[model samples]
Target: MLPQFFPPFADAVSLPESPASSSLGKALELLDLFSLTSPLVRIDDVIARFGFPRSTAYRYLKELCDAGLLAPASGGAYSLGPRVIEFERLLELTDPLYRAGQQVLQEIGDPGAVYLLHNLYRDKVLCIYKQGPDVIEYEGRRITVRRARGLPFPLFQGAGSLALLPWLSPHRIRQTYLRNAAEIASSGLGDDWEAFRRVLAAIRRKGYSTSQGTITPFLGGIAVPVLLPEDRKLVGSLAWTVAAGAMTEERVESCAEHLTRAAQAIAREYVKVAADM
Candidate 1:
């Protein structure tokens, strides 16, 4: 479940309705409904959420299932299908950041730690890849590293997301701050724009950001921004997550150092590849 401090993924923005009229558009909309928190959705739920006529909703669902974009599950529900897996594999193969991240993860050589690669897309922070230990026990329940690839988060919330903020132009930062003021305050990052700017300035000075239980309780995160030297553009961020109980000051400092080093390595490789292309 998403913590109350975090907003629902669907509510990130209000999508324009111009595309809703087309069959292809509606099909894509159906796909958008599947998210980490609500993976399995029922036909009735679709009807209720979208207010589509029963017949029309079923037709769209049928089309998606037929095309392997969605698949039937037990109890008359549906989940994303095999084709989605194919697309994800293709993305990993094609995305340079993912390739660089794989190398960085291998170099880090910590199989017990969780690492994530994130990039900015359409003004949102998108998790591109996740690696490390598959599961960990938390509060007596086994928590698997949830599949986060392609999951989007607000750009100003978590440490990984905020790592990119320092590189944004002051105008863009101000705009984002005003737009998400309530959420920013609710997140405990800041209660006002000045406070928020100070937080980002601190990250800029230290070259990394750290937080405890900001995104998810009992999970501590540290992140460093990936910036290419030639253009001085922010590429993305490298982040590590660990159980809060294990987050000593020494551990946090070590994680920050590792992430900063990995970020530098990824930036160099990424810049070289982009130049060659």
Candidate 2:
């Protein structure tokens, strides 16, 4: 079960995440057209998806390629470009959550575990920092700390995602429940509002969360949320995962103890970082 805090993922909910309102937003949404299966977006794909006129499609493509947010690929397609990597590098050098959580993880490094930090970002839980093998092969399937680094993920599953839920504000929680009831139900967090609250309440009362391969196969994780004491808001989560083959109940309790303490230190550092801003 998850906690009942008002939804605590990233920026405040600005509803209706579709039909990019500005030229810039529309152009950026074009980037969303590219994915693993469609790694190279062609002009027709953008026009078909966004319904942009032919001339506007070409212009947008040219502008994106020129700006290095996209690069022309073989067969008249475009792929995300070097600027994306540069931006990722820049964020790592400066994002406060990543900075604080990663330093703390270094202090508690374990060869057999994967340390992770996740936070809300525009209605999704994003793994902001990960210290582990890039991919773990389990049951002939390849999985990583996330589907892909830098990709946004739905908040309905995973230890990192579930752990942060209890610290959200009540209104946010209700709003999230309303908007994502189906997903919430499917996730087994609850099938109804009261049930959802009760489930999350149980997680909250426990002071941490655990998942048995809910988000990944053959791995179990224990997670603790990071709350800025002065702000009284849950901002993110810290978690560590261990392969089920090697996991034991004792390890879960010990990891919870270690993560709880690390989360506190990271929260304190977070306050310092916020102050400097």
TM-score of each: 0.71, 0.81
Off by more than 4 A, model 2: 1-19, 133-152, 245-250, 274-277
* Per-residue lDDT over 1-277 for candidate 1, one digit per residue giving the tens place of the 0 to 100 score: 3222222233244433455678788767887678769999899988988889999888999999998889999999999989988888887776777777877778878877888899886568998888877676666866555427777888867778878878776656765775778988887768975677667676787888877766776677889998886777877888888877777889888889978888889988886665665
Supply candidate 1's per-residue lDDT for 187: 77
- In model 2, how large is the Cα lDDT of residue 61? 88
**lDDT at position 166, candidate 1:** 80
Error of 2 at 211 (Å): 0.9
Candidate 2 structure quality by residue, lDDT tens digits, 1-277: 3432533444555545455788888888898787768888988998899899999999988888889999988888889999999998988877788888878777766665677888896558888887777666666766665533465667878788889887787766867786898999999998887788888888888888988777777777789999887876788988877666546778888888988998999988887776786
Of candidate 1, the 10-residue stretch with the lowest lDDT total is 2-11
Candidate with best TM-score: 2
Q: What is the number of backbone collisions in each predicted candidate, taken in the order shown? A: 0, 8
Deviating ranges (above 4 Å) for candidate 1:
1-27, 53-67, 72-77, 120-126, 134-157, 169-175, 216-218, 242-254, 273-277
Q: How far is candidate 2 from the true structure (C-alpha RMSD, Å)?
A: 4.7
